[model samples]
Target: METQNLGSSPDVRSKNESVKSVDRRNFLRSAGMTTVAGAVFLAGCDKDDDMTPTPTSVDLGSGDVGILNYAYALEQLEAAFYTQVVATPFSGITDAERSMLTDIRDHEIIHRDFLKAALGNNAIAGLEVNFSSIDFTSRASVLGAAKLFEDTGVQAYNGAGNLIKDANYLLIAGKIVSVEARHAAAIRDLLMPNSTSFAGDDIIDAKGLDKAVKPADILAAVKPYVKTTITASNLPTS
Candidate 1:
């Protein structure tokens, strides 16, 4: 597959100098952490439609590769969304909101780039995204979408934890998920200031745990945003 460079906003381009100055080994050591093209799914294809041509299927290989690609896919979507958010700056966006969203955008870009580098040739092709449902000019629309993506990401990492077989991969995943959880909380607070919505009953369970959605469900929910048809048939089930 051809390696596709996910385009960046001007801000991301400007920061490239500082980002490149960091020693790669040191960055990977401290971050252990953390693509675009269409949105991606772990292993399932969207429902077939007689009226539409079948979309090309990109397989996420099994084991650690599948998991990493799964994450790469989400990061790609997030980076794309936030890049647009920062570039356009929704109507009535406050300075605080702009700064916060810009930070999130940079983080997502880092995550996406890290995963791509880690996967190297194993990574799937860049995906095509569809953001038609989102009204970027509207604050409520953008923030609402941000909240959904962040929350869903937290759940995805939580649920996929058990599926990861490599100890090192699991450790890196843990680190990444913590950051994602923080993003979710921050977005929530922005949407509902001074309220219990940050850890509200909607996402928090009676056991004081966040929801851990299965791969199939997560893919289904995010399918609309992605224009590519991804196949996760090889993902670990047990």
Candidate 2:
């Protein structure tokens, strides 16, 4: 399905076009994720707290570009996980299960590509994923992992929405998060009958606003699947 227009202005479109021609390799080299270790150290180490240490720097440019790259990083992770699931087809997985997963895989790929296109040269290079911890041969294990991914995607978008400054970008994020929430609900219902994933504070509060997960919380949850560290320092703070 085609993405709905958020009514972004011509200026944003012009800026996106300017960076579209840049090669991915050059963009990666310039972003310099490898050299981020030094900056991490400089950020100071507070050993007393249990909080995950924040990365020293994020390579993607600030503003709208940084937000797109943030989404891209998540899409890459989700796409990789689903790709592995479809490739191996965990034992005892029903045809329906396989088909649903395949649809999710396609959706994640589309989301990843759309974010890359939106960000142009400011997009981060696809990071290598390590899914060795997952027992792809087991249906229970696979479904559990899927639940975690969907939940994370939903909360991540919820938490990051306020950080978006541009109305157009916020509109895009809202659209994507709605889709992610649907994916989460479907996966949840499949695992547990008569249960909506978003029910009972899974995603909403008493006021009916979506729950927001801070970047640090999300990074910690996704750390096991990702080998390369992603820095969120460049993302909008507001």
Best by TM-score: 1
Residue 201 CA error for candidate 2 (Å)?
2.8
* Candidate 1 lDDT by residue in tens digits, 147-167: 888888888888889999989
In candidate 1 the C-alpha lDDT for residue 95 amounts to 59
> Which of the numbered candidates is closest to the native, going by highest lDDT?
1
Q: What is the TM-score of candidate 1?
A: 0.77
User: Which stretches of candidate 2 lie above 4 Å from their native place?
Assistant: 1-58, 196-198
Write model 2 residue lDDT over 106-217, tens digit each, in one string.
Answer: 6676677667666755767767687887899976677778878888898899888888888988887877787777677666555553344435465567898766787668
Clashing pairs in 1: 36-127, 37-126, 37-127, 37-128, 38-127, 38-128, 42-232, 43-231, 43-232
Error of 1 at 94 (Å): 0.7
Candidate 1 least-lDDT 10 residues: 1-10
User: Candidate 2 vs. truth: CA RMSD?
Assistant: 16.5
Error of 1 at 216 (Å): 1.0
Let me know the TM-score candidate 2 reaches against the reference structure: 0.72
